[model samples]
Target: MKALIISDSHGWTHELKTIIDRHRNQVDVIFHCGDSELSENDEALKGVNVVRGNCDFGDDFPEELIESVGGVTFFVAHGHHYNVKMTYVPLSYRAEEHQANVTCFGHSHVATAFMENEVLYINPGSIRLPRQHPQGTYCICEYDEKEISVTFFNTHGENIPELTVAFKRK
Candidate 1:
């Protein structure tokens, strides 16, 4: 299965829609890591799994989400509550508790992906305001029985070659 992960849009609905439209048919699922700043009933989030961020004021948004797709369990969060900018310990512990194969979050607006303790952790970065990277980015993950491949893309749908990574499932 393939999943498209994005975060920290911070209210640029048009960009979000463009990204979603660009990959809607190609990916099996779409995840918005938070700070969307859009209302819960907004069309931009119609079919995406989303969470609440520190900047989000919507009462309808959840703080975290657990989703199962193609035999893989995913732990989703905005990461502020776990203090992800300082450390991953809290988030990692939460993932372990959920028995998640992958953990998706956004907070620092840094694009990064890695595997630790058999769990894949990914932060798609901020499409509206990037920090560590030159371009605003998001991530696409393709997974199967043997391995998982993650590719980062710019807001314009261009791939960030150097950021692409693959890992063998444990």
Candidate 2:
């Protein structure tokens, strides 16, 4: 299965819509790591799995979300509450506690993808206001029962190969 992962859009629904439309059928799942700022009433995210960002104030959202697709579990969070800008400690521990195969998050506005202790950690960066990196970016993860492969792409749709990672289940 292929999953599209994005974060920190911060209400740029139009951009999000365009990207989604471009990859609709190629992606089996859409994961939003947060900063959507838009209400649940926004129909652009009809089938997305979203977590509440620090900026998402409504009671309708949750701080974290865990989803199981194609027999793999994904733990997603917006990162602020996990102190992601400073360290990955709490977030890594949380992933361990949940026994999640992959953890996706955003808040640092810097893209990253890596595997440690058999768990994948991914941050797709900010789509609206990129920092550190020259361009805004998102990620696409392809996985099956045996392995997972992740590829990051900048706003211009070019693959950011340095941010890619592939893992084989132990």
Prediction 2 global C-alpha lDDT:
0.87
Clashes of each: 0, 0
Candidate 1 Cα lDDT to native: 0.94
lDDT of 2 by residue, 95-130 (tens): 999899889999898888888898889999988888
Estimate every model's Cα lDDT from 0 to 1: 0.94, 0.87
lDDT of 1 by residue, 123-157 (tens): 99999999989999999999898899899999999
The true-versus-predicted C-alpha distance at residue 108 of model 2, in Å, is 0.8
Worst 10 residues of 1 by lDDT: 53-62
**Worst 10 contiguous positions by lDDT, candidate 2:** 16-25
True-vs-predicted CA distance for residue 82, candidate 1, Å:
0.5
Residue pairs clashing in model 2 are none
TM-score of each: 0.98, 0.93
lDDT of 2 at 11: 87
